[model samples]
Target: MAGPTPDELRSVVDRFPTPPDAEAFGRADELLDGTYSAIAESWYPELRRLATAYAEGDVLRESVLEHVEAVPSFRISEGATPLTRRREALATAAETLDSVAEVSAWYDDLRTLLADSPDSRSLLERLLHDFGYAAAHVLFLGASSPEQVVRRLRWAYRTVGVRIDSVSSEAGTERTTFTCPYRDVAAGRCGKRWVCHEKLDRVDDGYVTYLRERGIDYQRPRGCAESERCHSSVARDGPSQWWPKTPPSAVEREP
Candidate 1:
């Protein structure tokens, strides 16, 4: 799973704090970890089997999905106590959309399982694109301006331990750190490209996708590797630029 969720992140604020049920939040995380493991255990093998079936001919996407199950799904009731159920429902958002490790594992699984199939690389790319697009939707949408992006991302990134420093009229958002937990995960095994392109770029790209949908231009953010803090801009498109033009201090107003 990913880090603490948007709900869990509701407390990950310094400026305007809305402390979540700290106990419930931790419980939700444990539930998610368990459910994720259950999904992998129950479905990964079956999925590999189905991949063989798909290589044979036309397999309905639904057919593949019918066999996949993760807990706390909409179709089923978790029936956790009222207090816990809300948190558990919130945990659903933590599913494997943005997980680089899970994504790469899927890549490996599909490649290994479907190696003998025709145009497998193209097929893999198509699958990955579909998955990535879906993942981006889970990032955010309907943001009104660059400031909205900053406001939302400011708290959301807190789960990953990032702190927003400022956002310029030009849509450049200064950050206390561009580094994420992913950078440290399996540090020795994964290279710079995997950490940056696969893990980090997805976060930037999700915002880019949403901005582009509104016909707003966006320049993806970049962080300084050498400095303690990385300041980057979100710039794109024509003369009419838009961003949350609030001064940095304004970001910390009382909730």
Candidate 2:
């Protein structure tokens, strides 16, 4: 087959599919490894330019690290299919790049410290002498903080999967409407939470309707002024009364 055109290569990389099984994960890994390697090799000059910009100071490194840390981790279930594994791997790579940015920052800090303290610890001096050049090379060439670089990294990390979009409101008559996605409620195993940031005309009716429409299962906020008027408990109400009480069903009528 003829080699893929630049646009074709981008299309393939930009729309990475989420794998569905272990076999798929392996396939995706191979594909990504080959594709990224090729791109990096072909675009060595551009990559070098970015690296030079990043090595100039800490701003780029900090920005790149911040972006990396912001990338979310995929949830994998028991007996996760190849697709899940692939998605997890991509996410992990993105995370690792973020970690690399952090390490780069540490390296920069160490250099600054060494510049100020030439007589620093022997161990520290030895370590810097060992890895300083390598660290500089990575900072300048591997991860740049420009928008284009960051965007490309993000694209490389996305799983080839469906994207979900949701919209919700905060008013209506329903009581409870929010639901928690965390595995352990007591220990707060998950960092997710349903927050009602909307200001409704009526706290109960509008809020309930909003929650119901959104399929959120939640409870009233403790010490809420409108709790007395709400049918749900004023404090510590159950999920049933929370707005957006459950995940929305497409076939079912909107509450």
Computed on alpha carbons, the lDDT of every model, listed in order, comes to: 0.39, 0.28
Model 2's alpha-carbon lDDT is: 0.28
lDDT of candidate 2 over 1-255, digit per residue (tens): 111233433332333222334444345335335333332344333333433433442122222222222222222222222344433444444343332223223333322321212233244333443353333233224332233222322232132221212212333222222222221223232111111111111132222233333343223222222222111211111232100111112112322
lDDT of 1 by residue, 1-255 (tens): 112222322221111212134454345335444433333455455555654544443332223333332111221122222233433333332331223123223433433332222243244444544454465466546565556555555566676666555545633432323544444455456532244433454445445556667654444433433233444444333332100111112212313
lDDT of 2 at 187: 28
How do the predictions measure up, each by TM-score? 0.35, 0.17
Q: What TM-score would candidate 1 get against the native?
A: 0.35
* Reference-based lDDT, residue 157, model 2: 19
**Predictions: Cα RMSD each:** 21.4, 25.1
Worst 10 residues of 1 by lDDT: 241-250
Question: Model 1 Cα displacement at 194 (Å)?
Answer: 3.7
Best by lDDT: 1
